[model samples]
Target chain A: MTTFRQFMSSSSLSTVKDAGTSAIDSLKKAKSDPSKPPRYSAAGLLVKGAKSEEWPRVWREHDLKKSYDVVIIGGGVHGLATAYYLATNHGITNVAVLDKAYLGSGGSGRNTAIVRSNYLTPEGVAFYDRSLSLYNTMSSDLNLNVMFSERGHMTLAHTDSALRTMRWRAEVNKLQNINSSVIDPQEVKKLAPSLDVSPNTRYPIQGALYHPPGGTIRHDAVVWGYARGADHRGVEMHQQTEVLDIMVEGGEGPDGKGRGGKVTGVKTNRGDISAPIVVNCTAGWATLISDMAGVKLPINTHPLQAAVTEPVKVFLPTVVVSGSLHVYVSQTDRGELVFGASVDPFATYSMKGSLEFTEELAGHVLELMPNIGRMRLLRQWAGLCDMTPDYSPVMGFTPVEGFLCDVGWGTYGFKAGPVSGEQMAECIATQAVPKLIAPFELARFERGDLVGEKGAAAVGH
Target chain B: MFGTRSFSFSFERSALMMLVPCPHCGPRNNSDLRYVGESHARPDPNAVTPEEWRAYLYWEDNPAGSLRETWYCRAGCRQYFTVTRNTATNEFENHPLPGNKTGAVDPSFHYVSSSVSPSVPTTSNAAQETETNS
Candidate 1:
């Protein structure tokens, strides 16, 4: 089930380690260098960094582009995060974050923020676990409570093959020192308590795959924290600055210029702004932005939707996932039940929620937890997702000079807000892309070396 | 073990004389999830001769007694599970087997191999972390 990181208490996180009893030490260990890496059973280790400042009123400016060392296109979490990481980690001062809309108003804001490290592939489990580890201490490091919850994550399997696949995944997770286990029907009842797993069904509650270090996070705080940090480090954040057309002078290799002149810059609604470096963090609109630069991106623009229900007494304590059901649900901090499902079958730019989705979601959720039938939905909305065939984000450099991309995050971009931004910043400052982000390069798709993250990326939690 | 050919088992004939291993979810009342008589299994791939191939393909035994056959829970579990069905009575029962229990039914009603695991820990917690599911 799709869930918000609303109820991932620190106490629940402590359960995976020395048995979830005390998290004070874990929290402390997270803030400083531990004798051992932050002992996260999720998937990877956690490293805490300092909190950054906010970009106040950066969203309302209608002014055009100003010159900068690096100008990142897209003011969402990834753009802001890229700015924050560039300023704090790399110390490259003159950076600008441009957004077409208000900050965090895109997929980054509309997503159901659940973070977990339970992945089937080694590369996947390792990468996401690192992000989960960072999230644990992100609030403190950023000096804000991003509400890093480590409640736990569960993947319920109905069929025996599905259950066996769960078992296989659990074993692989354990081999990496990631905590995951097999649970039977009785255990499933104890974890969710409200799940309907009558063994008499076709796909009975044979087992579940559990990750103790899995949980949720606050999506807005992540955007805010990075923006604040980047702003503090003298990064100019320009919101509502829509790039109308990109002017790339035709040239040879990275030295091409248009109209027999050197490369100029982008013409935004506000005015023309020239910059050497432009990072496409436009997210769902990434393809459009890339096309402006005369580059064809390996991404398809698709819309993903999520919804919330009127706040009720908080009943969901942990994040739940049903791969078979294709429905993931969790209750938010203020008691609103958050629901998310796979992207609609068709790809469009519209954000209108559909009734067909509501019917399908209600049916699946009711089957899992029959008791919540009394609740009513509060609202539903959709966001654009630049999807890739392999389901991995398109990061790193492009064929165009000074143009970088942090787009094509699919639906899992929200939870990876901090990490992706942090890494993108490093790439910008050093002018050297990190190898970790190397696997997700646009070149991978062309070369067929794509790092397939479909196993861990389907649910954006 | 997963990429092999087809399997066989005792199939219960419904009131309409349908078979047992048809693909109907338990709740679907009107679906033809079964067929009358028993499903057949192929001979060992290691065996030689056209006769062996024919025997594995179309041969059958009429031991309508406690018949032991290969059962594929396609619609239900989508996994290969062992089951003992009374040939004469056409009753179905499921049992776990070690490795690939292709035809070990007549001699053994229980899990007869050493590979049936009690608690082999995997990386991803099969969610059944507690003892109740065991």
Candidate 2:
């Protein structure tokens, strides 16, 4: 079997060695006694409530610094989590996270919050399973209640091909030690009683891939937890600060057209701040951000719309998905049934919600659960997804020096946030792509070594 | 119980309806057309390098603003044509007509050059220009 380490060219290996030396030197210079946040505990909560004391701000507002060791582009879960890990795990605290809007204003706040690891590919299953473990421990680690409801996940199969794919995914997941299996219609009906599993229904449920260790999390809490944690550890969080362009020297005439030089700094709306490294964590605007550095990515931005019905009694027990129907329905703790379909048929940056989406979503959701036809939709909105040719993400080093990418997540970036941040922090500190993410390098596209996850990624989240 | 509550429908009127003008057919709902992706210039096969070939095949200038893309009138004329649209607003520019190669449909509208062109000839101002020039 070929290993990911074997795929690394000798030139990149030499670069890693050079970077390792600098990384060690920087680590030695980093502050050893960074300030910590106020610990959250039952005793503290009781004391505060008894004393009628107000809780402090979750994160502090910081003035734009002249320079930093690293600059992260987005303040979403990926960026904030990376900052948190860099501060906590690697002790690299001279990091600045810049966002054009408030934290969690983009895809971080908009995802369906479904978390699962029952993937078809071994690489995908292993990577996402690690994320699942991280999420399992995230609430306590962050000292924030992420409300992780591990109420299992189900992907229904309406056809034989879909069932065969589910079985293949189950076996692959099992080989990776993930708790996933193919269950018959009777079992699925038992799990989700609201589903119309009767043979008379349109696209009757045949079977499903049942994964017990999958469910949803409070996405906003995850973002806030990471932000507060990173902020406490001397990492700066800059909101409403838009990055205008990236400064690169000796790279195809400063246009980022060719890939040879290093990033010097970033020009933002406030001012130009110098940094040795810049990480692009912006999802919807991934292509635009990378384009500023002249590193072209094979990514297109498409809007994925989702809607929520009015709050009612919580009837749905588990997260239900159907790829053929192009819809996934999951009820929130607030008792609102959140519905999401596949991305719009065409690529456009516009995020306007359409009545057509609601109409079709109503039809599909009714087809799956005939009893929900009368449920009134309360609100609908859209978020941008940076889709790659292969449904998997593009992580780690790009062709340009000192510029790293954690983009091309498409529709499933939220669930992988924790692991992506942990690995990205490691990558930034060590200056080398980790083995787990080496298969997802941007150069893979050039080499035609694509990690195809369309089977599991599309409409499954 | 379903009939007891009167539906209070409130949605964006503009986004709910979109009209795409097909050259063969009159203006119709956008659902009548199939959206082809951004147009790209295919590299010359005989002289193209591997990197160039791959870049042409995969790399996209996915601009957030105006983009020139192809659309097939699947439900209308069953023909393909190019239109310059602002991706940010989902609005088409200058009432684009098919087979207008001269790209001066509206003198005020500037054309963004793309490799793909409409093969079908149609009655448009550009066709009249061709006739007059010939």
Q: Specify the highest-TM-score model's number.
A: 2
TM-score of chain A of each: 0.82, 0.91
Q: How far in Å is the alpha carbon of A105 misplaced in model 2?
A: 0.6
Which residue pairs in candidate 2 have backbone atoms (N, alpha carbon, C) closer than 3 angstroms, thus clashing?
A256-A294
Give lDDT: candidate 2, residue A434: 89
* Model 1 lDDT on a 0 to 1 scale: 0.63
Question: Which CAPRI tier for candidate 1?
Answer: incorrect
Q: Candidate 2 on A1-461: residue-level lDDT in tens?
A: 55667657555666665655554444334324224435666555554565676666778887999999999999999999899999999999999999998999999999999999998788888899999999999999988899999999999999898899999999999889999999999999899998999999878899999999999999999999999889878999999899988998778755644488689999999999999899999998898889888898988777888999999999999999988787899999999999988777667776777788888788888999999888999999888888887788999998779999999999989989999999999999999888888888999879778898988964642
DockQ of candidate 2 relative to the true structure: 0.22
iRMS for all predictions?
Answer: 24.8, 11.3
| Candidate 1 to truth, TM | 0.65
What residue runs in model 2 are displaced by over 4 Å at the alpha carbon? Answer: A1-35, A253-257, A458-461, B1-17, B98-134
Q: What are the per-residue Cα lDDT tens digits for candidate 1 across A1-461?
A: 42445335454444544433233365456448422223332212221212232212422232444566777888888888888777778788677777777778788788888887677777666667777777888877765568877888888877776787788788878988898998887887888887887866544567788888988788888887776666656777777677777767764424353222333577787777888788888776776677667665655445666778999887778788876666788878899888888764433344556666677678778878889998899888877777766677788887777778888888778767778887888887777878668777776644556565665644421
TM-score list, all predictions: 0.65, 0.85
Q: What is the TM-score of each candidate's chain B when compared with the real chain B?
A: 0.39, 0.55
Query: Alpha-carbon error at A312 in model 2, in Å?
Result: 1.4
Q: Write the per-residue lDDT of candidate 1 for residues B57-78, one digit (tens) a residue.
A: 3222323233444434445544
Compute the DockQ of candidate 1.
Answer: 0.01
